[model samples]
Target: MGTLKAWMDYLNSINGKEHDSFFKPYKEGKWSKAAIISHMMFWDRFFYEERLPHMLKGETLVGITAEQVEEMNKKAEEYAHSGITLQEIIDEALKYRQMLLDKLQDEDLSRTFTIKDRKISLQEYVNGEIEHDEHHLKQLKAK
Candidate 1:
């Protein structure tokens, strides 16, 4: 939950025009703020839909491949620019993220997953995702 309030604050501070403007792609082929937000949304949804059910049941999962990651990102970016309202996307993300966190609250943090040949705990993975959120939040703030 660390830094989650900051994300909510930022999102709440923005108006519809500001939200829609985020759909404009950045220079040099970088992702726009809308794309970034949607990217986070997609990953959170993935965890909710694909990863968490397994994790909650104590199922060990293989890490997603690089290609799969790229595919997801691409789809997220596409969705961001596909004329959907930013509010809808953000709402979807927050919904799934809340569900994921709530479900994990009582779970064992010591649960391990092997990603790229290294063992990582659920706590560590969640921390990494929080950091990712911070990184993107900073980027969105910069624009």
Candidate 2:
């Protein structure tokens, strides 16, 4: 299966137990799995709404800075506890994923965005998403 297909299938299989368990951090002050998931969803929404439009318009893209990434994590964690249920997160994640997937034409995958002064292709970015998903999924299930 495609990376997104497999990754999203794993997400679709998450139950209440998994969702609740995801909130358990391996160490204090670290991100819980749900927070990580929320962060991913935020970016998925980001590209779905922001990056895709720029690419579609053939506009230049901007790179995300470390400060911005930190802030995004903070925002995601805040939202995770802001009364949005895990189910809601999952639902929104699916929608965001679909939004991007719908635009993933071969031409779209060839699109590039400027990040860190480098041109990053949509295909490269999507691969990074899979890598992110795998990293977090392992941490989430680690004993």
Candidate 3:
């Protein structure tokens, strides 16, 4: 519940910003708000739609490669500049979060997964995503 509350607060704070500004590019070489949104959306979607199901099925979760991480960043940049609306990205993130919340209630939080050579539980992974989101949000707000 605290996590959900924090997410709601974060969403509310972003809603206060201008729509155009929310998706505007950050300083050159940095991720724009749109890119950040896409990154969040991607990870959220991954955890709720892919990773969670894999874990539930007792499948081995392979580590992420450095190349894949780079690709993810590249895709985020593409998504940012793709002319998709910020609200659409936000909605996707919300849907992903809700899916996680729903699944978490019934799943074992301690279930572990291997990603990038590290072993992390479902709870830890989700918290990492929240942290990543907040870091990007700060970057977005500072721009």
Candidate 4:
């Protein structure tokens, strides 16, 4: 979770720096940095509110369909362009992230759950999210 913590710290450090690049797309047809952050914020909220509760109760996790994922991403990108400030997006994301971190503090990382017929442990799920974060960070940092 060190990478997670570091990612949180990086977000905090850039909360309201007023960088123009943050609002521009990295490439034509690609999501802007703010949209990428918004996408992450939405997922963090989903994991914290929709998944973690059931997961902690040892329930088989419900999986989201590809269409649903596409819809969610569309909505997130829309929200990012809906006049909301970048700082607000970061704050919301951090809040959910902190909740997630707090909730996992005493959790058994090896606890397994089935999502879409695939079995995964909490640790593996979190590691995947961490990788996702790293991938986006690189995208954001690229010129």
How well does each candidate superpose onto the true structure, as a TM-score? 0.83, 0.82, 0.79, 0.93
lDDT tens readout by residue for model 1, 1-143: 56445565566677344454577765457888888888988998887788767665555677888999999999999998898888877777777777776788888978876656677787787787888889888788884
In model 4, the worst 10-residue window by lDDT is 1-10
Residue pairs with clashing backbones, model 2 = none
lDDT of 4 by residue, 101-125 (tens): 8999999989888787888888888
Alpha-carbon deviation at 22 in model 1, angstroms: 1.0
Give stretches of model 4 more than 4 Å off. none
Error in Å for residue 66 of model 4: 0.8
The lowest-lDDT stretch of 10 consecutive residues in candidate 1 is 12-21
Indicate the TM-score of model 4.
0.93
| Residue-wise C-alpha lDDT for candidate 2, range 1-143, written one tens digit per residue | 14876657767777444456666665677777777778878988887787777866656778778998889889998887787788888877778887777777545576777765677787887888778777776766666
Sum up the clashes in candidate 1.
Answer: 0
Give candidate 3's TM-score: 0.79
Q: What is the C-alpha local distance difference test score of candidate 1?
A: 0.77
Q: Which pairs of residues collide in model 1?
A: none
Output the worst ten-in-a-row residue range by lDDT, candidate 2: 15-24
Q: How far out, in Å, is residue 15 in model 4? A: 1.8
TM-score comparison, 2 vs 3, better candidate: 2
Give Cα distance to truth, residue 83, candidate 3, Å: 1.6
